[model samples]
Target: LPSAGSSRFAAAVTQHAPAFKGTAVVNGEFKELSLDDFKGKYLVLFFYPLDFTFVCPTEIVAFSNKANEFRDVNCEVVAVSVDSHFSHLAWINTPRKSGGLGKMNIPVLSDLTKQISRDYGVLLEGPGIALR
Candidate 1:
């Protein structure tokens, strides 16, 4: 993973995904998670721009609402952003009508260091956030 402000970025995730481990908010609880946790299953790893946003919430909640469907097919859904875990929890606690992520069924991770975003080729290096 790229260090903070590292120049090595935007190389694209051409090979296997760069492994990552970090704090995540899952079902309104904090947990330690890593890419390895979803082993033996199809992993839908998605990266968003921030915790509190307009379009971002829709995508997060849509995937979250459809989490069971993914699980039925033996897959796991995980969302990542450059925001802190606290922010993710707060968003989950908020209602969807208010533009919060609301009751996330999938795990939402905190990429405060932005390493995951960087490794995935979604990091906006200038602003230090994910692209999608």
Candidate 2:
């Protein structure tokens, strides 16, 4: 048995690190993905507020620019938000010239149910979104 606090903490960790199941934007396609997909690789899982927003693109682009660095270290960056795969693709298709992500090598996951956001403890409950 565990203390109330300890139990809550364990539950929280289990939720985030558990087997994640969803479709990810990969190589210009939305396909099924899960934590097991990254089992043999170092993963830099990050969460952002949403797509097409200020401050978010800055971080996304910055990560994009350094994507090779992570890859060099044998690590893959997987960014997530409460947006749909279509939204992620749209943002990727839009050009930086028009305030959108352009040609990013990393995959952006869609957590439309907000389950991932909540599990990661990055969700802005007030607005029912993530905080980035």
Candidate 3:
């Protein structure tokens, strides 16, 4: 991850994804996750600003609703946010109408350290959050 004022802050599209390890909410349970765990398969990872916020649930749910589509092409979807695993679990347990993820098929990961978001070049330094 680049520090503030670093000129190289953007992630390279064609390169391998940066290595990451963290706790993630999976099916209402917390589990350890790592980038290497998905080796040999395509990964469709995305980062959202945070959990239980505007547009975040809608986007994640839309991705979850198309789980089969990703699977059909041999890919797995993973969503990341600056929130903790507990927050992810809470949102997953809530209903969609109430700004929750609602039975998401994809795992919602917690980048609590903000390192993953920074490494991915999506962290918003001013707000201490991620950007999409």
- Per-residue alpha-carbon lDDT of model 1 for 5-111, expressed as tens digits? 34454443444556889999987999999989988998888999887788899888899899999999999999999999999999899988898877888999999
Candidate 3 segments exceeding 4 Å error: 1-9
- For model 3, residues 1-132, the per-residue Cα lDDT tens digits are 463334345655666577889999887789999989888889988999977788778889999999889989889999999999998998899887787778989889999989888887888888989888
Error of 3 at 81 (Å): 0.3
Task: List runs of model 2 lying over 4 Å from the truth.
Answer: 1-16
Pick by TM-score: which candidate is best? 3
Root mean square deviation (Cα) for candidate 1: 3.3
The better candidate by TM-score, 1 or 3, is 3
Count residue pairs with overlapping backbones in model 3. Answer: 0
